[model samples]
Target: MEAKKDNSGRITDWRSYERVLLPSIKDLHRLDVYEENGGYQALRKVLVSDDWTPAKVTDEVKASGLRGRGGAGFPTGLKWSFMPPVDPEVPRFICCNGDESEPGTFKDRQLLEYNPHSLFEGILLACYAISAGTAFLYIRGEFADWITHIEVELAKLYEKGYAGKNIMGSDFSVEIVIHKGAGAYICGEESSLMNSLEGERAYPRVKPPFPAQKGVWGYPTTINNVETLAAIPTILNKGGDWFASVGAERHPGPVLYGVSGHVNRPGVYEYPTGILITDLIYKVAGGIRNGKKLKAIVPGGSSTPILRADMIEGVRMDAESLKEAGSMMGTAGMLVMDEDTDIVGFLRRITHFYHHESCGQCTPCREGTGWLEDIVSRLERGEGHYRDLDLLTDLCTQMEGRTVCALADAAAWPVRYTVERFRDEFEARCRPSLVPAGISI
Candidate 1:
């Protein structure tokens, strides 16, 4: 595939990247060819080379300006550096978050499905950089097919001496274990994920003595998104500066954007940051599936605020800038809605997800999510009154800042933003009328 942007707006690069990333993603099913295509070269180099130190790896990553691709876009190297100084007495580990459950975001699954060794190598290198002896890949339980993909690929990697004890015949070691989560959206959050991994119902925990200070059985454990770890090999192998150039200056690298809904070719595309949202939906996805008109979009995942068609101009695919646009670049889940889409019905469906997924550990999120969904359901069915909108706003405000974690805030952001931007449509349907007493609302 050519690396240049085409007239169609779809990225014409990954077909060629497949050649370069062969065995990694290029020749995935063929294990021997994977090795022949330079699969474990990066890990071998890092493990055997005396010139590079853990500090050097961390410093280079910091210089690269690579942020977490999961959503928040926190600097990856900075987060890894938060690991407390290696304590021989205390157990230290790194946990790779492969639980990709965000709505409209399935890009991470492709990375894990088609080319899992990239993630494996990345995880091993992360442990090596942080001096972690034991690392775990926390994969979501729903990925039944990819579980076999990962299991097979991992066994091949282990046979190649890329994993298990004493890798590359060196003194350093990182024993990787694959643990699965029992389908929970909250498990995508790091703390809640840790909880689920520990054989309990996934729920948020208090912070301040954050996960870095104590985690995973009360040891210093590092949790990073699967996509975050997948970027490590390329960054270390090609130099951080090169990796930084792949995307926009703020959040650089080839972001795997999952563009779905009302698009012709709705799938994941690897592209540089700052690509116009219009180009992505229209050009890349073949212009909204058919002759339909574009309406609004969720630039990030569902947690982000909505952006009307006019608002997508010059929107860089970065973190801070997306926040400036009254949305977040969350999990790179780009959902495009068509003009004929029912805005009320949409919110009803999304609100249902927030309510069902709420852990109920906290009062505001547990109660508030249910309230938001009830209001949305009523409004969708044309059974709501005008005062209900005010009630919705007030309830969302109450839940926004009072939860144990950001799940409550996540539920409220879209509810508040959808009404704020599209009140006319909602009010048109939801406003109560004392018409005929015989007629149903």
Candidate 2:
């Protein structure tokens, strides 16, 4: 695993890095294979050991600096600590979000498909920590095959006594239920997912009664992303400090960088956090397709603010660095655009997605998303006016932060950022305003 690096000491070869989330072991999804690779040892250690407790587990994860991989990047341990003290009379639940519905995000699917036991084990660990008897594993409905695969593996866990009734002959008993989503993008949101789980329409719930306080059927619940939970086993196996030492000081540990768009090798590459954007596009993903100059990037998923190529000159793929770089480390689903890319058309497509995915509960999101798509589509079709540009930005301002969920903000971001970053391209497509810039209608 000797990595070739430039003078800056950044690993130029992604292969040199050892993978944690997506390990190299063959058939690692199988219970025996996962067990052979040291799976569930953390669960057994925690459940059986006198030295470990729920608080200690939470603290260890806090020390690891692991953040939510499902767009938000909040501290996982801190989220775990939010669960109220375990009450034997009252039940708590652990919801594993496997709804990888974001357009550019596909890494969670691999984890569910290739190494599900880790997730199952992680779910079990979460149940113990929260003092919950039941855990719900929510997966996207489009992943029918993967859902079936997980079901088979889950049955194996039950057969081996790793799940249901008792675990490793200990007092702790847990049951995992697999709930398949209807492929709604809004269901990816924690509250919306909970609502959908409770047999209600998938709409993002209002806050204050946040999932921590009241969740899925009115139980104190802790919802974690699939990748976030999968990382738990490794963090517990290799001490949290060791996990913290692997990547960037602020946001550490291995991340499944799902690089897509105009790249020679557009696939999920497992590397430590804070990998230079250039190192990922050039070294890991085998550089831009056909050696074209880099144009722009949606550094996270489609929801994150888009960045011009120049803006990402020294950017690293971590939450802190990306924030400084004017974007977010959203799902680490980097969408690379080549120099010849159509900015306006790309924005049109993105706006369409958010518009279609809006749950319609929020007035701002439901209407605003539609307006965004209509405006972007108008520009793409060569019927937009120069005034439409200002209108788009204005619409974004009105839509952003006005909805119950971030979908409005998500829809607004690309419209605002793309128009601002690549205004020239948009201006080229638009007709001049009918009146002077200062004139009223």
**Model 2 score (lDDT):** 0.90
Per-residue lDDT for 327 in model 1?
Answer: 88
Show pairs that collide, candidate 1.
1-15, 1-16, 9-284, 10-284, 247-253
Question: How well does model 1 score by local distance difference test?
Answer: 0.81
Model 1, 338-440: lDDT tens digits are 9998999999999999999999999999999999999999998888988888889999889988987899999999999999888988998875555687878
The sequence of per-residue lDDT tens digits that candidate 2 reaches over residues 144-236 is 999999899999999999999978999899989999998799999999999999999998988979888899999899999999999998889
Poorly placed runs, candidate 2 (over 4 Å): 1-15, 435-441
Give each prediction's root-mean-square deviation over alpha carbons: 3.8, 2.6
Candidate 2, number of clashes? 0
Per-prediction tally of clashes? 5, 0
